[model samples]
Target: MIEAIIHGVILAFGLILPLGVQNVFVFNQGAIQPTFLRAVPVVITAAVCDTLLILLAVLGVSLFILTFAWLKTVLFGIGFFFLVYMGWVIWRSEPLKVNEAEATSFSPKKQILFAASVSLFNPHAILDTIGVIGTNSLGYSGEEKWVFTLATIIVSWIWFMGLALAGRSLGKLDSGGGLMKRINRFSALVIWGVAVYMLTKI
Candidate 1:
């Protein structure tokens, strides 16, 4: 059980450490929101999406679904375009002001929708959860498998909250807008880079 938990933590963290589109969006939302509490929707939505994916992967459902070649192609096409659009939006985002009005802030619905898109539309994320985590689970069963799944799920939730907190800290430091602009540009690049990679795979 200990070994399974350790493997889960290490593997989940390793996969999530990359600055992918989903992570970047979560961090950006945290930085843009006036307060950490206001970023809860984004954090929760992302975590929930990951949880669902992890559960499906562990149950072997994702593998069965992905077995169809046409479905994979369709997913790749949708993900590629969605990522490109998101990248453009981020790149063109105006610099956030310290005193930005609440009226201009993203509504909870928008936040949830955007978070879901970032989390669910990425083929890489799906594959990582299904291909990597699912394949790893093949070695464990019953209690061990449950322990491993729980560990990964816990790590995912904690990591999302931690990222939001870190972004909140950075937001405080970025009152001058310089740092914020740079971060946005870098995030856009990361999103675009992932889109390009996906395009190549398709």
Candidate 2:
């Protein structure tokens, strides 16, 4: 069980370390939002989506879903289009041009919607969750299996909260908004790159 917990923690961290669209959006919201609490909707939504993915993967449901070639194609297609659209939005988000607070302040509904989109719509994220975490969960059984799953879920929640906190801290420091604007552009490019990569995979 102890080994299971350690394995889960390391695996979760490894899988999430990449600069994926989901991570970038979460961080972006944290940095742009007027306050830390304002970023909570994205954080919570992301965490919940991850939790859902982890559960589906561990329960073997995701593995079953992955067996369908058509499903993968659909995922890749939708994800590619979504990333392209989202990238454009991020690139154009000029907090300084419009009323700074009003421009950056996404409603809770929008936050949740975007958060879910990045989490669920990204085929790479889904594959990682299903292929990596799901495969790993097979190594244990009964209590150990569940312990591993719980550890991974906990790590995900903690990592997202930490990211938001880091973003909030940086937002406080970037009063001029210059650095954040650069980040938005850079983030958009990264997201577009991911979209292209997905198309190649398809």
Candidate 3:
């Protein structure tokens, strides 16, 4: 169980450490919004989607695709192009809008759906969770496997929620705009790095 949890954290960080759209969105949201209340709905949405992927990985369906050599090749290419496209978008994104009204009356459903669109549908996120994490899960058994899977899910919940909470601290930041732009730029670099790594390694 401990081994699984450790692996899970490693996998979780592998994905979480990247400067992807999710991180950029969360940072931007935190910087310009009423983060305490807004972050919950957003993080909850992302965490639920992440949980579903972890569950799928645990069930072993994701591992099945890894067995097919050609499919794996195709998936790597697909993931690579997808990351490049997303990186371009993030690179071009305008600084987050600071609408006080939007922050105060944030719509939970809209945020959830928006987050789902980014996290669940993004091919890079899917490949990381399903392809990378799923492929790695095969080296465990019984309690260890379950612990590892649970740890992966918990990582998603903990990291995103933690990011959301940390964004609340930006409320005290005088230069929120400058700070957020830096976060977005940092996230772009991380995303591009991961994408390159994924493309080359697989």
Candidate 4:
């Protein structure tokens, strides 16, 4: 049981540690929001989406879905285009000042919508997530499987909150928003690169 917990933690961090669109967006919102509370919608939405995916993967639902080749292809195509659009929108957006954040920052509704879109549609997140967890979970069963699954879920929630906290620290330091501007463009480029990679798969 202890081994299962450790394995789950390690595997989850290994999968989530790499750069990805979902991570980038969450961090970006954390840095631009007027306060930590303002970023709660994004953090919650992303965490929830990840939890749902993890549960499905561990339960064998994802494996059943993967049996359809066309479904995978269709998902990839949609993810690719969504990433492209997100890249463009993020690239052009300027980070807002604390005084201006209320007027210009992403509202809670927009944040939830975008967070859900990136979380649900990003094939990179889905494939690697479901593929790895679903396969690894095959090693455990019953209570042990659930324990492993819980450990991974905990890691994911903590990681996103940490990312947001780190971003909030940066946001406080970058009062002029110059650093965030560069980050936004760089994030957009990273997103586009992922989109291109997804394009190749489709």
lDDT, model 4, position 142? 95
lDDT of 4 by residue, 109-156 (tens): 988877887888778668877888988999999999999999999999
Model 2 worst lDDT run, 10 consecutive residues: 96-105
* Cα lDDT of model 1 by residue, 30-60, tens digit: 8877788888999999999999989889999
After best superposition, candidate 1 residue 84: deviation in angstroms? 1.8
Provide the overall lDDT of each model, using Cα atoms, as 2-decimal numbers: 0.85, 0.87, 0.69, 0.87
Best by TM-score: 4
lDDT of 3 by residue, 13-131 (tens): 88887766677656555554644676677888888888887788768867676567777677667656656665665566544444443533235675565566567655566677887
Residue pairs in candidate 3 whose N, alpha carbon or C atoms collide under 3 angstroms: none
Per-residue C-alpha lDDT of model 2 across residues 73-175, encoded as one tens digit per residue: 8888888888898889889886442125554546788889878888887876789987789998999999999999999999999999998888888888888
TM-score for each candidate, following the candidate numbering: 0.93, 0.94, 0.69, 0.95
What C-alpha root-mean-square deviation, in Å, does candidate 4 show against the real structure?
Answer: 1.2
Error of 1 at 96 (Å): 2.5
Of 3 and 4, the candidate ahead on lDDT is: 4
Q: Rank the candidates by lDDT, best first.
A: 4, 2, 1, 3
**For candidate 1, what is the lDDT?**
0.85
